[model samples]
Every structure is written in C-alpha cells, then in structure tokens.
Target: MNKLLVITVLVALLALSAESFRVPRQAAAEEEEGTLARITDTVKSYYEQSVNTASNYLESIKGMKLEEKAKNLFEETTKAVSTYTGILQDQLYHIFYPQN
Candidate 1:
C-alpha cells in the first residue's frame, strides 16, 4: 500500500514536470521555428492529456455501480447539503434580525 502510494505521488510529480519546462529566452526571431513549434505542441499535448485524464476519471466514476455503497454515499451527501442549507438559513435570519 505504501509503495503504491509513493509511486502514485512520484508519477503525479513527474506528470506536472512536463509543464515546468523553461521556454527559450531567445528572441522569437532568433529561436528556430521548429523549436518554437515543438515547445508549443508539447504544451498543447500536455493540456490535452490533463483534460483527458480528468474526463476519463469522471467517466470511471460515472460508470461505477455499487448500489449499497452508492446508497450510503447519497445519504451522506444529503446530510451534508442539509447541514449547509441550515447554516445558510441561520446566516440569512441573522442578517434580517441583527438584534437576535
């Protein structure tokens, strides 16, 4: 478990390192067009990869089926929403009834 967690963290860090590449400091005219194109293309590819990663993750979650687990999750989510709603109501009441 620990090894898997460490590997996942390392992979995530490495994934982010793709975006941290320093663009050439040279003037645009001085930099080769191919080099500029490569850098831009790499950034675009990484952006697409990140978006696909998120889309895939969402699809996985949407595809999951565990009725019992989902029931529990729904109940918990309902309680959370109720709690937040009550808090908001209290704040609104306080705003209207500042003396209270």
Candidate 2:
C-alpha cells in the first residue's frame, strides 16, 4: 500500500509538470494567431481603401475631354521648358562675361 501511494504521487507530480509546459505553448500559439489575424485585417483594410480611392479618381475624370487635357498639359510643359532655357542662357552669359 505504501509503494502504491508513492507511485501515485509521482504520477500526479509528472502530470502537473506536463500541464505547466503545455499551457504556455497553447498560449503562445493563440497569441501568434491573434497577431496574424490583426496583420491580415490591416492589409485588407488598406487594399479596400486603395480600391475606393482609385474608383473615386476615375469617376472624377470620367467626363473630361482627353484632347483638351493633353493640349493644356503640353502648353504648361512648353512654358516651363522656355523659362528653364532662359535662365540657363542668362547664367551662361554671366559666366562667360562677368559684369564689373
């Protein structure tokens, strides 16, 4: 009877130690899953927001004339280039012939 009692106590101690180890592993796994779920939700939200922004931009430009847009863009580009060229010419002239 004494030997049986000893064996039962040993078995109970082993089971308690095993349970201690198992609890942390389960908790870690649950935490990892929660982190992954949060990352997935954030990525999905950003993707949806990007899609909505693109849809809104397309809707805003849907009725515009492409030819007129192109013409205006070209005019703006030409004016910018002309201004840059004039500034460059003035710098070169000053560099070659410095004023007194």
Top TM-score hit = 2
Question: What would the per-residue lDDT of candidate 1 be over residues 2-98, giving only the tens digit for each residue?
Answer: 5466557556655654544678465776655555456555656776677699999988887775667889999999999999999999999999989
TM-score of each: 0.35, 0.37
Error of 1 at 76 (Å): 11
Tens-digit lDDT string for candidate 2 (17-81): 34333445335544444444555556556656776998988877876777789999999999999
Instruction: Give the poorly placed runs of model 2, Cα more than 4 Å off.
Output: 1-63
Residue 59 lDDT, candidate 2, scale 0-100: 79
Name the best candidate (by lDDT). Answer: 1
Quote the positional error of residue 64 for candidate 2 in Å.
Answer: 3.2
